[model samples]
Target chain A: MNDALPPSNQTQHSSDQDKPNTPITPNTRRILLVCRTAPYGNALARESLETALAAGAIGAKVAMLFLDEGVWQLAQHQKPQGIGRKNHSAMLGALPLYDIDTVLVDRDSLSKRCIDLAELGDFTQLIDSLQVKEVIADHDVILSF
Target chain B: MTLHTVNKSPYLSQCLADCLDRVSAGDSIVLIEDGVYGINCATSETLSALNKAIAQLMTLGVQFCALRPDIEARGLQTTSANCPFNLLSDGDFVDLVCEADKVLSWY
Candidate 1:
């Protein structure tokens, strides 16, 4: 697993440098995207990811938290062969490309599901349930999917 | 006021119920996706419970609405006389989001 620190400095600089003279507005809301469902059973997983990407694209500070059945999204070697849906596992890897580096998975969620930390991708951090509450309190907007 | 969005059906999930419990007076609720199903005024066990909860919340001055596109996609009607929610277009949805102090989306 890659334990490298996120390159947030570069992303923040790039997003801000373009509009140096512009005053910061309330419109630039900090968003936390909470994923509570498993990846394939519904459209929520994909829609949440798209929302995060869209928020990040518009230079909003975006973070994602995985809870409950959402930890299944971090499982390795997923192949939705018969599911007739586009595989979104690779899309998680693309979060950093959109400058969405703060990906979190609940510790209790992973433990309850018997998911190993190694099974998750390198970009995700394992946070406790209390930290999840703090994460929610830290963001200006919360979107659950 | 907060703009709350519920995208899960109340009959299928406890999301709408939980959201209703937490929303303060003057907050706006926008039902989207499968949540538009909660707009049914039909008399059934689940629908009755949902209607009761919505009526109670409305008494507290909370505003309720559903996305027009999602309601149409689900083949559900949201008339002012029967339904507790108003219809919001895509543009109106954006306006509501921007007008609110914060957005809380419940799935």
Candidate 2:
């Protein structure tokens, strides 16, 4: 295992770092990726995409959830040309191709944002935030971006 | 167990340091919500830098995982490589919290 020590905490030596969070055995490790922002505002959206892509590439059964403003990342009819930017919607359209096709958007966020169910591009699912909570409860890992 | 989570996007320039700060050598990080932003090629000099980072982090003994449903909805889950990436079910999330003594969020 690669070992990189923290600078300030170096002196507070603890064997905690050596402990394995996940064993090499079967079915023990998992992660949940949660996205709550649309692209173009900042790297949060891009980071969410890249991180999910990275996890999937690693052979992990990663789970991703979209909540709050995060649902905007999946909105339909995205045109970045007005902003002179590449369309994130286009990139999002390609996620299923990477084997990461469990996209979920919060139902409330959709209503709050006035996103029509029909507007969602192919490969996206719209579920209530309550369902999202259930989804998180079932995972071995939970992360928010 | 120690979980070294990274919460910033690669393009932001703060995530690298943030990861280095919160995550250690053996801990694992699950990409969540906007925290997934760190991997976009828009800011990556290398198209696979985000993937490379995940690989590199794992090599350091840290496990890296991401949420499946979110990416699936966002249409971004296909970006990752095929490794032992974890997709936690609701029960698993509870176990994660129970399993780890400390949980640090980058947000």
Candidate 3:
């Protein structure tokens, strides 16, 4: 409720007319997609993965972090057929093909859900909360779903 | 400053609280989608706590806003005197996004 705006000199605005079709620079942006929702119950998990894949496909340096209930997304032996939904766990295997191999999951989240690292397969790297913060700070863009 | 967009009802999810926790001074928060339910200002403990949070953050120069269309769709009443937040149009929302260095969406 501070009606006062930032100093006019400090305000930054990227007017649509400012740069038309800006070229992709050699320094690709580092994007970190964070997933905190369980799969099947909602579209968040699947959408987050799709976003990560899309960013990677567009040549952005993409990384993913699974936290909270999001760790369940990597659980093995998932059979979503009963719900008439395709099992999205298998799609995670295709991440490496998009050059997005740096997928991290919170260790505490997995333990709280009674999941083991082996169950998440070899693609995911189990990380602690402290390391998770480091990964967040390292990224140029952070998208949470 | 970051542009934080909350799209879930505060009563249903911790999205607003989580977004507030991560916001710093001068950051702006826009209640959109179901988040427009938060500005109801009805007689309730949750609304009081939310009002207090908004007032306190305002002291530190944090800006609070709500999407106009969502408010209208939900039939919520807001005015400069009664409401503590600004109501913005879709175009204004886009401008706010351009002004901020980063955007964070909470649902």
Complex DockQ per candidate: 0.25, 0.05, 0.19
Off by over 4 Å in 3: A1-27, A42-44, A81-87, A93-97, A106-138, A142-144, B24-26, B40-44, B47-61, B78-84
Q: Stretches of candidate 2 above 4 Å error?
A: A1-28, B1-107
Q: What shift in Å separates residue A120 of candidate 1 from its native position after superposition?
A: 0.9
TM-score of each: 0.54, 0.49, 0.65
**Model 2 lDDT, residue A59, Cα:** 69
Candidate 1 local lDDT, A1-145, one digit each (tens): 1235367866676677687556545446677888978898888999999998888888898899988778888788888877877777788988999999999988888888888888888889989866765676567777788
- What docking grade does candidate 1 earn? acceptable
Task: Name the top TM-score candidate.
Answer: 3
| Model 1 lDDT at residue B38 | 80
Model 1, B46-82: lDDT tens digits are 4566677678878889998889999888787754466
Error of 1 at B76 (Å): 23
Q: Which ten contiguous residues of candidate 2 chain B have the minimum total lDDT?
A: B38-47
| Local error of candidate 2 at residue A44 (angstroms) | 0.5
Question: What are the Cα lDDT values of the candidates?
Answer: 0.80, 0.64, 0.79
Ranking by lDDT: 1, 3, 2
Chain A: TM-score in each model: 0.81, 0.76, 0.80
lDDT of 3 by residue, B9-29 (tens): 888887786566556678899
List the candidate 1 regions with Cα displacement exceeding 4 Å: A1-27, B1-103
